[model samples]
Each structure stands twice: as C-alpha cells, then as structure tokens.
Target chain A: MTESLQGARVVIGSIGDDIHVVGITILGHALRNAGAEVIQLGIQTPVEEFVATAVAEDADAVFVSSSNGHAAIFCDGVRGLMAAAGADDVLLYVGGNLANTAAADWSEVEARFLAMGFDRAYPSRTQPAQAISDLVADLAQRRSASNG
Target chain B: MADNVTNERLTDDAFHAQRETIFREQLGRAPYDLDEALAFSLENAKRGTVAAVLQKAKATGVAAVVPRAGVASWEGQRALMQMLDEAGAAYLPITIDSLTRELQFAEAERRLASSTTEVSALNGYPIVAHGIEANRRLIQSFDKPVIVRANAVDLRITAETGLASGGTAFVSGPMYATLEYSKNTPLSEGISKWQYIFRLMGIYSEAGVPMADDAVGFSQSGTCSVPALMHVGVILDALIMASQGVKHIMLYSMLQGNIAQDVASCLAVEQLATEYLHKLGLDDVSTYVASSDWNGAFPERRPDAYGLIAANVFAAAIARAPLNYVKTIDEGIGVPTAESNADSIRVTRYLMNLIGRQAHAWRTPEIEFELHLNLIQARAILDAIIDLGDGDPVVGSIKGIGTGILDIPFSPNIHVKGNVLPIRDASGAVRFLDHGALPIPAEALEMERERLSHRSADPSALGYQDVVDDLQFLELDTFDPATGTEVKA
Candidate 1:
C-alpha cells in the first residue's frame, strides 16, 4: 500500500548547536522519497530559522533532529515560536538523542515534547523508515481533521 | 637527551601532585581513597584480571571475545554479563551509561532507581551513579574479568572507581576521546585529564596490580578509513601511557572490511607500538593487539550483517588479536537484546576456535603485501609525528594534532580540520583519496595515489558522494558503477 504525502512541504534540520547532519540528511531523503517537498536547513539550525522558514514557505511540517542529546534544551519554546509566527497548525516533529540522559523515559520525553507543543516526538535511534511512516500518517490525520 | 630530561621533569612527584590537585578540582568531587579501593581491587584481582585472561589467551593462541554491553539496573547488566559469560566471553565490559559518561551522577542515580521498577532508559550501566560498592557487587557476580568502557573526558573518578571496584581494564586516550567523542573539549584539556587517568593507572601498577590500560585506536574514528593515522594515534598514546607507568597496554585496531588489510593493520599496530614503546625505554611494558570487529555503520540486511560480522571475527582470529571486541548481529539496528549479544559472542568464539585450529594454512602473499604496506605507511606517519614533537611523542602528538599533520576523518572537535578523506581501492583496501595536511612521506602518499588511480580514471573524484557511498557500501548488496545505484544480492 502506498501513502502519499504528495504536495506536503516540510522544513527539516538538526536544531540547536548540534552539528550532526547525518540523521537529518537521511530523514530529509526519506521524506522526499515519500513525496514530500523537504527544505533542509542542514546542521546547527536555530529554532527561529526553522519557524521562519516554515512560515515563509507555508510548509506543512517542521521536523527538527539533534544527535548531541541537547535537543530538549535547544528546542525549548520552539512550538511557541511557530505559534507566534502564525504557523501553529504546522505539524512538528523532533527526534535523535533528544535528551541528555540516556536513561530518560521515552513516554515522559514524548509527553514533555507534546506539552511543549510538538505533534510527535521520537526517542534516540528511531529509524528513518519508521519516522517517515509516522510523518505520512500524521500528515494525513491533520489533513482529515482540518477538512472536517 | 633534552627529551629525556623533560620526561623526567614531567614525572616528578611534585608535578604529579599538582596535576592530581587540578584533576581533583575538575572532578568537582573529593578523590575516592585509593588505598581502600586498591585493597578491594587487589582482592578481586586474585580471582582473575583482564591482563591475566589476555595473557592466557595469548599463550593458548586463542582470541578472547569481549562484548560492549550495559543496561540501567544492576540486575539488567548482570543478566547481560551472565548471558555473555555463559556464551564463552572471556572478558565482559561494564559500558557506562551516557548520563554517567557526561558526569550527571544524580540523574544516573535517579534513572537507575527508576529503571528497577520500570523499563530502563539507560543504554549502559551507570557505574559512577551506582558507586564503588555496587560496581564491586556487579563485578563479583560475574566470574569473568569485567572491564570498564566509558567515553568521559575527565576519567579520573571513573578510573579510580573502576580500578577499585573490580574493573580490570579501562580504555581511553586523549586524541581518541577528544577527536572521536567530544566536540567542545580541547585536545590539550583532554590530554591533561587523560594524563591524570594514566597516573591513576600508574599508581595501581606501582602497587603491583595487574591492571590493563587500553589506548583506543581505530575505534575512535569508527569507520573512517585512516589506518596510518589511527596507528600513529594508538602508538603515541601508548608512549604517553608508558611514560606514566602503565605496564600492560592494549593497542586497539578496528576492522576495515578487507581481510588482508584488517589483519595487516592489526599486526602493524602491534609491531609499531612495541617498537616505539621499547625505543622510549619502556621495554618492560607488555603490549597486545586488541581488535574491534567493526565500529562503523553495519548492514541493515540480517544475512549480510551476519556475513560481515563473521568476516570480522575471522579477520580478528587470523590476525591473532588476543582481545576482540565483538559486535552483535543487531548492530546498526540500535541496542541489541541480551540474546543477540550472546549469539554474537558464540559466533565469534566459534570462528576464533576454528581459525586457531587451522591457522598454519592461512598465510598468503596478499596478506604479506598488505602487512608490508601497512607497516611502511604507519611508520612514516609515526616518524612524522615524532619529528614534529622533536623526538617526544607526548609533545609530538599534541603538536601533530594541533597542526594538521595528523587528522581523523569526520572528527567533531573544532580543532580538527577533518580535511583528510579515505576511500577504498579496487581491492577494497582503504586508501587516502585526499591526504589533506597529513604529513605522511612523499613515497607513501604517491603509493596511495597510485593505488587509487587504478580504481577510477580520476583518482581525485572522491567527493562527498563517494564518501557517502563508501559509508553505506555494506548496506548495499552490489554497486552499479554506471548508475551508482545499489542492487540487492
């Protein structure tokens, strides 16, 4: 079965001061392959840049990746920034070494991100295929909810 | 003569005391009473030490397989170790959790406590958080020697605690930790901190403790193909450790896929390290070649991944690496289950035993050629680093890395230029595509260039795409030269 994210535009990048671009590059490639138009900001992307670019491009989603384990600290209030930029409806996802502590509870981490206004959160080592599939489903759900 | 005098001055008691004070302050905690820890460690040392096991393996001509493993709770880690021990693992590792590695002791404690009641969030054992007593219990629970594998920049506390708490060996080097692991940590700072660690090892050795200290080699760059750079780094670290009085040194080399090249790299590192240590008047230092199966990205396909894993096991065996860090079949697929971890060890043990029995028939001209080339190239790099440091490896390594004379590919350290690029030649042996500022001799550089030229019309065509392809080569079943697309086997 094929799930199409045909006209969906997404801004993808590694947020915070993290220069690890490998994960985000793979994520961007997977999103693109899944038929989404991905605008990758590369590594060490400031949260403001992600929000601004999403607003400018009218992107459907903003996905932030960080492998340096400081994603929570760097991504704080990023959801509020998107809201202030009037892009609150945009789907938000963050993943990759998301917390400094390796012993962090994924459910708690996911809850923390959800409370921070992210639509989805992935723990460390989440495969690209799984993230892509989740993105497709989330995008479809958001579209359906908006249509209703 | 001047270098020897400098070495003497550096080894003075007052100098070490001052350095220890600074290291203690950096530790941000009081130093654990070494006497207490050493007594306990010495008692455990009687049962079996990592050094003894390795020495026994060397004598028996058997490769001892050690798996890198850790979990949140003591029970979880114990269970994992027990599983590995039952699978014929000679030595096991208490791989520290990330929180502990980053010195978040409180966080690790909380996680460890919570993980017991709930599913653990930790990737490894939180030895620091668990403290000395708990670590000792964990070690005593396992019959095999337990080694500590951590990536902390300030390893003073970890070293003291691990050595005291029944950890038989600890692995780290300034260059390996700074360039391969930390981003903001300066090479000088890392070197100083590791100097303190080496001193701690020295104290244990002085007490006549059979402790093993490993100078992390190719595993640092983890898949980036710079055999000579890795060899130089390992040997330089060995010299520094020897200066600090570490008696048993394990020089590591990661497998690079090519069987002949991998075996040659292992042998070359062993020979170069021994030669350099002896030249530096460390003849009493016993050195061993430790092979890491593969520290890089692994194949996603199960069969292919197992194939690669088996290949590495064979390479380690044929190379006669006494210590082998076996990677699980579930590598590149996130943290492995206890079952998979044991399975990997079993496979490695089987391969090592089989190869040991049939060792005499394994020699070939290809192997000799690779070994010769590796030794020459590694020696050239080593000589350049020494010359750069003015005949002192400690000063030379710092200078070598400070200058771009020595470079590791994909290193995150800001000081690291990361200009050197590595690509596989036609025979799948890693060759320098762009030597960058690496100070290898002209003959070696020309030889590498000539080797790569045979693979592609434009030897310098190794751009970003080529590196990306090379990184993902194992995952791909076959390469279509024209389309550059991967075809599944």
Candidate 2:
C-alpha cells in the first residue's frame, strides 16, 4: 500500500467500438509498473467478455475505458452482468470520453456511471497518477477493515 | 509459425500467381480489369499525380497541403475533393471505409446501400463496395492527384481496387498497418500482405504508370513519438517497399509541437530514407518529404483552433516539406464541414505564400542537435532490427518488435513489446522515460533521463502523473509557468 498497488489483479478494456486507447494504455502500463497484475482485453470488447475475463482472472478490480463517446450505452449491463456472474464485490473503475458530445458539466456524467454501480468513475482525461493513488488508498482501507 | 513465404520480398512469379487469385476472387462483383486500370493510371499521371505534385512543391519551395476527408456516397466525396482542390489542395485523399479496410466487403455494401443520411454510415469511402467504376468516377471527378488512404493488416483488395480505380498514390506500409489497425494479425502476415500490394503497384508502374508510396507503419505515436522512432519506421517501410520495385516514395513526419524537433524530423526522414535506400543499392527510387500536422487534440474554441492549425502550417511551411498533411479546425468537435476543411486550406495557402519567397533552410543549433539525435536513435533501432533479420528489414522488423528491441510506445499490437515510454522534458522535447530493452547505447539513454530530470517541479524524480499530464498537454487551455505544465489539470 505504501510503495505501490500491492500486486492488485486488475482487468482493463475498451468497451464497444471505442478505439481510442491512449488513456487506458498508459493506465495499464502504470498499473503494471506499480506492481499490479493486468489483463488487457483491448478495444471493441463486449461487457459480457469483460465480466467473463474478470471472473476467469479472479481480478480484484476491473477498469472499463471507452472513447468514442458511447460509454453510456456500451456500459448499460456491465454491473448487472458482474452481479449475475457473482463478482459483485469486485471493484469497478470507468473513465474516458463518456458521452457522445462534450458535456456541459462532467459531474452529471460521472453520477450517471456511479448510479450504474461503478465504485469510481473518472471524467475525461483524468491522470493515471490520480487514479492509481486513489486505488492504492481505497484498497488499503478496504483490506484493513476486512482483516479487523 | 513460420511460412515458406515469410517476410522476404515476393518473387516475380510468386506475385503474379497470387494476383490471379486476388483480382479474380477478392472483388465482390467488379470485374478486376488490369489492362484498363493500368491505362487509366497512365493517363492520370500526365498532369495530376502525387509524385508529380510533390516534385512541383519541391521546385516551388512550398509544401503541398493535403487534408483528410471522405464520405460513403460518391456525391459527397466528389464535393469534398473538388472543394479542397479549389481551395488549393495539391492532391486529394479517398479514405476507405472501416469494413472495406478489414475486407468485410458484404457488410460495407449493406451500410452503403442503407445509408440514408448525407454523411456515411461507414466512416470512409468503400473502395470494394463501390467497386472499380464508382471509385474511378469519384477520382476522375476532381483534377487534383488522388491518394488512397487505408490502414490494416490485409490491404490486397483495397490496394488493388484503389490503384485500378486510377488513384495515383497509395498510403500505409506493412509495419504501420499491423501496429495501428490490426489486433491479432502477426507482423509476418503484415509484411506479406504489403509485398503483394507493392508487387501490384510495381506491375502498374512497369506498365507505364508511375506510383507513389510511403512507409507509414505507425501514426503520430501520439504525444511522445520521440522523433527517432518515427524516422526509423519511415526508413524501414521505404526499404521494404522499394525492394518490391516501387520507384517514387514519400516520407511522412508527424509535426509534434516543438518546431526545432519538428523541422529536424522533417529533415531526418529524407536524410535517413535516402541514406538507407542508397546504402541498400535502391538508388533509383526518388524520395520526397511530407510532414503531417499535430495529430493530437485540437482546441474547442474556434479562434484557438484556427491559431493552432495556423501554427502547425507555419512549421510545415518553414521546413518546406514537399507534402503537408493538414488538420481541420472542426477537429475538436465532430465531422468537418466542407467549408471548415476549405478554411483550413486557405489558412495553409496564405502561410505558404508568405514564406514561399525565402528558400533558405533554417539551421539553428537546437535543430542541429535534434537532427543528430534523430540519426543516432533511428540508426540504433534500424541496425538492431536489420541485425535481428540477418540483414533483411522484412524479417528484422518481425523479430525486433517481438524481442522488444524495436519497441514502440502506446502500440496495441500483440507482437510489439510496447515497453518504451516517451514523455516531454522541461523544454517540451520528447525524451524516453523508459527505453525498455532498446539496444541504444547506455550513454544516450542516460542523456534522455538526465534531460527529463531537469523538470522544474521535481528535478530529481518523475511519475505516471507527469506522463498523464504530458498526454493531456495539448488539451490543456493554459500552462502553469511554475510547474512547467497546465494549472487546470
């Protein structure tokens, strides 16, 4: 927790037809460097595939990246599918151009994803540093509480 | 995993034998007419051809501005080419549709037939679905020389269709198609696909039609394209294509924000490509340089977008590259209107006019340093790749990328190591933060690290945050002078 991600098993992918890979690619690289085990499903992945991979890898967390502005539709059944797969306890993170058009306010977009059952939803262009730092702190707190 | 036809240049009989099947079966319904298509290209080469336009641009000391645009219907694409031509575009581009790019001809036909909107359901013009006749009509509608633009592992169908349709030039190289577009295609397959395409191009050239080609095996490499990595790709792609008998070639340099590095990269592509081609005894092949405008985020504000586009044009003009691939102001939003695309050309033409009088090359100390760095870094990668292939670039590319010696940052290709990390230094020059297993000399790698450590915010260390910021660097509205980055982020 103090030095890095503490070997968190993470699964990441671009949902639907979104091919913009810069954001999650850097995040994956940073996660791997931070001592997390990452399985990258790559662009154009379906929600069911993400859930299946998460279950197969027994991933502690799953990060969904979308950049063609179709995340709202593409991520519709993500959490429900995870719950169906009995991986409801697994952490979910979502980010990248979340709307078709640039939003007047990004918070509404974040709230929309949050309501869909994501633990954390970052707005467009959020730095991997911030994402990693938040994940490390959150995982550490969660693990300690369960131990007690 | 190895095939008998692996990576090496295709023999004459091998190419024709494959072509009989490709032309006979690849096109859905359009009869692949070799004699007629070759004759069409030969006629089009008289006044409007990419190679001829570049030659004119070089002679006139102005960069020929070419913009990106395409639609599903013939009517829309014709309008785009004509408008850009009237606005002073030296050449035109027909971007192929995604389905056609992937060889999904039937799906592309469905989309083209069902598309009700003025804009295309498919992202680009479907070369295969439209077939040879419709594509020829679209190309012959405009006077400007046209270039076929499509990126994928398999381009046999698209390449043949475009050339046969009378387009004078073709875009993309093998290594580029695999890394940027393909998710599962092996690098060897990429090389073989291109060999087939190049052999087809060579046949056309021999049949009295001159064709232009380039090795654009990778895109802008986005934010941190260390000028050298791109230069090497162009050089290597050029080498492989020329081996197939392609005579006229162009080198594409991505215009990263830094003028010094940008100009140096423009110089390096010509320098390195010429040197490598000459070294390999392919001296008959002619080379021209083209620099593409910034391939990153454009400003949302209209005025700011115009300013950014103008600045990019200025750099390309200063370098006097034979061809300058321009970006539109409407890029930050959605699809660019014909007016906006024309407006970008007007801005580029004005700058070209203003700077066209002076032909003196800019040779500042910083530019010279970047040029030197580019040569060394590229040579390191190229030499390593060639050595990996036992003196064959085709074989070398596959082996080098597989081993991480030729690692490209941000590549989604499974074959690529993607271990190299590039980040902007304090002065805004791209430096390798993590060089991975690249066989570059230790001293040069250390130099990159030392340069990055000069960041004012934290001189001794860097983190993923810096890289994140660097990736978002173009999108930032303003820079915080103290942190050497944006205050907004």
Q: Give the TM-score of candidate 1.
A: 0.82
TM per candidate, chain B: 0.93, 0.93
The TM-score leader among the candidates is 2
Candidates' C-alpha lDDT: 0.75, 0.76
Checking candidate 2 for backbone clashes, the offending pairs are B176-B217
True contacts kept of 2: 0.11
Docking class of 2: incorrect
Which stretches of candidate 1 lie above 4 Å from their native place? A1-148, B1-29, B479-489
Which digits, one per residue and each the tens of the lDDT, describe model 2 over residues B417-461? 888777787767777777788877766776666666677444346
Compute the interface RMSD for candidate 1.
6.2
Report the CA-based lDDT of candidate 2 relative to the real structure.
0.76
Error of 1 at B305 (Å): 1.7
Where does the lowest 10-residue lDDT sum fall in candidate 2 chain B?
A: B1-10
